[model samples]
Each structure stands twice: as C-alpha cells, then as structure tokens.
Target: MRNNVQPSNLSPDPRADLMVALSTDQREHWQHAYGAHPHMYGDQPSAPALHAVEVFRAAGARDVLELGAGQGRDSLYFAQRGFTVQATDFSDVGLEQLRDRAAAEGLNTLRTMVVDVRDPLPQADASVDAVFAHMLLCMALSTNEIHALVSEIRRVLRPGGTFIYTVRHTGDPHYGVGIAHRDDIFEHDGFAAHFFYRYLVVELAEGWHLRDIRAFEEGELPRRLWRVTQSLTG
Candidate 1:
C-alpha cells in the first residue's frame, strides 16, 4: 500500500446520468475517483490486470510498458520483480504521487514519465519487449481512435512482442454516466466535470487474436467490467 498518500475531497459514486457518465462529458470521474480514494487507485491495480501481468511475466516478458499506470502500483511491482518498466500517463499529480510511493518503498529502479497515449507513443518502434496498456485505451476515445491505438501498439512492438490491455464493457453505465447537453461536460456532487469513453467494440478490431476474455458480470446485475487479451500477430 502507498503510505502517506494525500486524499482529496471527492466522493465514490455512480451518478444516475448514464449517457454523460461514460462519454467525455463526465470523464474526469476518474480524477475524482482517484482523488477521493488515492489508495484504491494507487495500490490496488485491477485484479484481472494483475493476473495478466503475472501470466505475462511467467511467459518470459521482461521489459514492459504501462500506458496508464496510475500511482505506479504496477510499475513498482514490475521493477521489484526485476523487469524494466516505463510507465506513462498524462496526469502529473498521479505520477508524482506514484514516485513518492516508489521512493518510500525504495524501488528507485522504477521509471515514471509523463506521456499521453492519445499522442504518438514516446518510445521507438520495436523498442519495448512487451507493452501493457492496462486500462488506458478504453478512456475517452471513439471506436476508430481506439483501433488506431491498437494499431500503433502493433507498429511499435517488434515481431513476437506482446501488447496486454483491458477494455471496459459496453453495458457499464458508470463508464458514461452523466453528461451535459453538449456531451463534453458533466455534473457530479455539485461539481462539473469533463470526460469521454468510446471503447465498446474491441472484439471487432483487426490483427490481434484474442487470448483470454473474461466476463465480470457477477456483481450487481448488468455487471460493470470485462477483461480481454490480445497477442500481436505479425
């Protein structure tokens, strides 16, 4: 767990505004979610993602890329495991806290950088031995944009390089919960927020073949999460 992590005055919630919640109209939901519960996001990498990382490591992946590594939980874990990892995200605050946690844990080998996956990836083609998108590609993107991201991963990875990631399901109401009329803004707990999500069609993408697809609809009816895996087929 990340000790001394700063907490924010936000609430954990699932607003009733469905359309806006999943769209960019309410994307900052994550910021607030992490702000309200830094430890939850900082220490607790998703269960499916964690399991996937273990499996990848067992399969001989060493160098790793974490696209949306919040608070460096996964990054530090990989570094401690002796795998070289470069984790990137657009949130400086999140990365700073991640660094603080790493410093506290004495895992100085972990590398954290500020990179936005929406732009061109910062590494050279075939540079990384393996890539971990985690929960990155699913955020605030159109279907085509998400496909482009997958394609970009393929382009960057060397032959036989692996790209691991997870996509939220289409039925997740929390994904696009509340949005303003313009569809780019949302209001929650008396605060207005901005957000987007367009990754409901990962099963239809070209190139990569599905390795493991887990359906997580066992919770409160309609379920809220899905786990999908892909292997780069060049």
Candidate 2:
C-alpha cells in the first residue's frame, strides 16, 4: 500500500451508486468492463471492499487475509496500516497488475498469490486473525459454490477469527445493472453473470460466530452501490 493512501472522506460516484441501489444491469456492465480491461474493474477500489478495512480496523484486527483481493486495494490499505496482509485472487493478469501496483506503491506488507477461493487457501489451519471478501464470492460461483467456499473459510480461520464481507443483493432493480431476481443474475460483457444480495450464517462451518451485519444501497449517483456487510468473530 502507498504510505500516502489515506482513508479519505472522498465523495462517491453516482453511476456506482445507482448500480448498487438499483443494479439489475450490473452483470452486463461488469462483463463488458472485464472484457475491455481484464486487469481491473473501474480502475478503483470497490465501494464495499473499501469499507471492509474499516470494519476490521475498528474491530482491532492485526493480521488479515483478503480473499479475491483483485486490485490489492483492501490488502494494501490494511498493510499500510501495519497489518500483515495476505492478498489472494485468481486472475493471473489481475494479480500481475496488483503486484506491479504494489511494487510501485512500495507496499510489501501485502503478500499476494493467485488462487481460487473455491479451493483451500495456502495457509495453516486456524492461523488467520480475520478474513475478508468484498463483493467477490457471488460474482465467482453459484450458491452451492458459496457453501464450499464458506467451508474453506472455516478451515483457515482461527477458532475465533473474524470474517467480514459485502455481497450483491438479490432482486434490486433500480441500479440498472442486470436481471433482478432471486439468484441475482445478470448479463455482462457478453458473458452471463449471476449473483444476489445474499448472506450465509455458518458458524461451526466457517469457524466463527456471526458478529454483525449491515447492508448499503446506492443512495444516489455520487454514492451508488448496495453493500451487504457483516463481521464474524470468535
């Protein structure tokens, strides 16, 4: 993370806001965006992804695992804050850019790897202090995949480590992103995308207790996005 990247109280984007609040058309846009630029989406940190750092920080997390850490935004932010951050993402191209960006910003605390979140993490069991994913899971797999991934999360976390996340909401239509319905399905960049405003309460399965949950919807153009967030703690 760059030493100068502070948590700014910067204003939000209206387009992003609309998508979050009423994003039935998001899948199409994202697929298009990814097709156009496979290395990144929107060239910035995701709205909920940014907030996860604060969630951990406020919860007093020291070491963190950022799963599906595409651009290294959350990972770098945590690293810059003195947290030992292990950032993981599956895209080789995305990870390359992340490494390049990290190098340019001199963020070494962020140790990164290219791995599928559906598989076991390259970590010792019960070793992490906290785990976080921002809008990463639902975009990657089906509800069945979510359960398996959640199982993996359970295996890596300490008996009482925290898991924090934000995911797409099902049936939100105002955002103009995709087909709004239960599965949070959408069409994007020529590929089919499916996701939803979803939640899973797995304790023993995830190796933690559900601590808190919050949801955010795109309020306006400058602040568009729906964020379903939570803290899982020991």
Candidate 3:
C-alpha cells in the first residue's frame, strides 16, 4: 500500500512472455514458498484488509470469514479489532504460522483452517457475518470455479453480509504475458493468476448488491487490481 511502490506502467519482466507450461501444481508452489519464506507477505494487513475493517464495522459485522488468509495478517487484525475470525488457506504451513502468532498473542477470537476455495465452505447456511479475500479470487481458479466459490460465499454469509475481495485485472502488465491456461489465467514464474475483465466482475455480482469496484495497485510489480465490495440483500 506504499504510495511509492512501482507505478502503474512499470516495465514488464523480460521473461514474462515465455510460453512454458506451469508444470508444478500451484499448491506445491505455495507450500514451498511458505516453507522458504515464512511471513513472506509480512505482518501488516493489506490495504484491502484495512478498508474491510471499517466496512465490516459499519455493517455491524461481529464474525468474519477470511478466505486465502495466508499467515493471518488480516485475520489477526480483525480479531484484534474484536471480531471473531475464521482464517483459512489451502496451505497448512501458512496457517500453522498464523496459528502460532495468534496463540502467542492470545488472540482467542481468531481461528485457522485449511480450506480450498474450489470446494464448498464448511460453514452452515447463513452463518457468517462477513467475508474477506484479498487477491484470492484471482488465483489459478478457472471461471467456473470462481463462480462456484462466490456461490459458496453467498451460502455461508448471513443476510445483509458484506463480501470484499480484490483481483488482478486485465490491465496488469503480466496479464497476457505468460503461459496461458484456460480462461484468462496466465502463469508468471511459478504462480498462476486469473486476470479479471470488468465484465466478469459484473457477472459475479449478479445476485448481490454490487456496491463498489475501486482500482488499486499493490506489490513491486504494482499489480493493477480491482477492490470489489458487494453485499447480500437481507
């Protein structure tokens, strides 16, 4: 969220255009990354997470379900803000690190789980107050999987629940640069990301009250992203 991070039109990586297949499963790549670089994304909550706290608070949300919550930076922040938090990720290594931090801090309001967004959420219908997922929907999931995940989010959320998410978009420098997967996904280095088009966001919000889509940038790559906020109608 640093203002002086890479600019919007930063030079693209020279190797980004390589068409080599991303042979390794993304799960393995993430596991190895977390093993090699514990707390890699650092401890500070993301910009989107900071924004979500205010939105959730004003919406009177008391419990939070955070998907793809790597290392629990945002989840810990939510718990510290006095909201009950369920933090989940596909990587157990990352969640373990998160759990240790939560335990050391005595953050009893925070809990961690290993979850793959492609599957149905474990929560019962109309159970959670709000959901947050920073840069999760843009992961290697196909369009169908992403749609299904949104449906699952809807199922788990209580009426009038807010969901805030961010995604790298077609305007990103790496969008058309790497190995092509189905849909708009492309692999750069070992990570595969599904770059969103604006239309896809609209389609995903069809059943929800689409509240906002704010453009933002993140990381040294200065990934162009959309921070979307939508809410379920009571």
Candidate 4:
C-alpha cells in the first residue's frame, strides 16, 4: 500500500444549520425524481460499476453488496454476470423498480433491501466478498457520518475483501455552484451533495489499503468523479 499522498486540512463547514441530517424531505426528493421518469439513471451500468465488475472478477469475488443501488442497473448487471448481489437503497420506489426488473429478468441471485447508508448497515460482519457504492458517499452526509459508514463497510467486508466506490470530486464543475451548506457541501434545487477531494479520499481509507484512485467524466452533466478502490489489510 502506498502512502505517498499528503493529507490536507479541508474540514466540513462549521455552520450548525448546515450540519442537518438527510431528512425525509430529501428522501422524498429522490423518490419523486425517480418516480418522474420510467428510468431516472437509465438502464446501463455506470462506468465505475462496470469497472468494479472487472475488478471483482479479477479478484475472484462472488458475493457482492451494493449500496445506494438505485433502480438496480449495476446490481442486475452483476447478477447477470453470476455474482450474488445484495442491492440496497433508501428509496422504496427505486427498490421496487429494481425488484420488478430483476424478477422480469429472472435474476434470482439478486436481492433488494431498503437501507439508509447513514445508519448501520444490516449485514453480518466479515460476510461479503466485496462491497460497491457509486456516488452514494457524496450524498447529504456529515464528515463524521461518512467515517461511521466507512467503519461499517470495513466491518461487514470479509478479511482481504475489496470496497469500490465512486464520488464527485472537488474538481467537478458543479462543486460550488449551489447554495453553500459548507466548504464542500452544496444544496442545489433541494438536492444536497458533499464533494470529495483526494485528501479526503485518503482520510476515508485510513484503515484500509488504498489500491487506486482513477478519474472519469460522464453523463449530460458531464460529472467528474474519482473511482476509489480499497482493500482490507488481512
């Protein structure tokens, strides 16, 4: 594991008002957003997700856990590729859509669960071979909450298991465009996001081996993000 990246002191916004929890209204915002379209994020797996499948296959992993698996595009993709996937998200409507699609495809290897990533994940410790999340950590979460979630992920992953995630980086064009909740957090049109810097990524992977951090841009928004992969040190 390389430790060449220096840590930075960029902290969360200190404003009390800005440190609010991800409210039901925010959940409703996502629910309504997905409900508005037949498929909000589209049917294709994200670039990072496809990359994760390649990495997991290379590592010989089979049992995969997906966080914030909205509409289950990636989860279904994993299932179709013969991985047993536990797909989780906070949105019932989204999970229902995923379930319907998975059922229609006869993806018996895929399971859906309604879960809030801010809370302790409902999974057994050291059970899963790998965990995957795409842009889930960049949601409306405090720095402390993110740390807790990372700890939870570390606990649930088996020894030497891998965790792959993607997040909008500070380099993204939309980083500071909206109402400032904090230094790195912004709320735009009722959608809140916390952007990640490379230093923050290093900080989050403190207890793990930071395998790689690759940059990519995609979508009509042309979102700029980092695909971060980490592994548990056995």
Give model 3's TM-score versus the native structure.
0.89
Local accuracy by lDDT, each model: 0.61, 0.59, 0.88, 0.86
Per-residue lDDT of candidate 3, residues 1-234 (tens digit): 213232222243343323122323787899899989988999898999999999999999999999999888999999999999999999999999999999999999998888887679998999999999999999987666688899999999999999999999988999988788756789889899999888788888989999999999999988999999999998
Instruction: Report lDDT (Cα) of residue 37, candidate 1.
Output: 68
- TM-score of model 1 vs. true structure: 0.71
Candidate 4: RMSD to truth: 3.6
Model 2: lowest-lDDT 10 consecutive positions: 1-10
Local accuracy of candidate 1 as per-residue lDDT tens digits, 1-234? 212232321242234244334443323655565566667644655566577677677667778888888777778777777787787876666777788888888876678888755567778888776777655655654434455567777777776666766655545554345534322333445334232232233333346766766656423444355566666654
The window of 10 residues in a row where model 1 has the poorest summed lDDT is: 1-10
Please give me the total number of clashing residue pairs in predicted model 4: 0
Q: What TM-score, over all chains together, does every model reach?
A: 0.71, 0.68, 0.89, 0.91
- How many steric clashes does model 3 contain? 0
RMSD each, Å? 10.7, 11.8, 7.8, 3.6
Q: Is candidate 1 or candidate 2 better by lDDT?
A: 1
List candidate 4 segments past 4 Å from native: 1-22
- What order do you get sorting by TM-score, best first? 4, 3, 1, 2
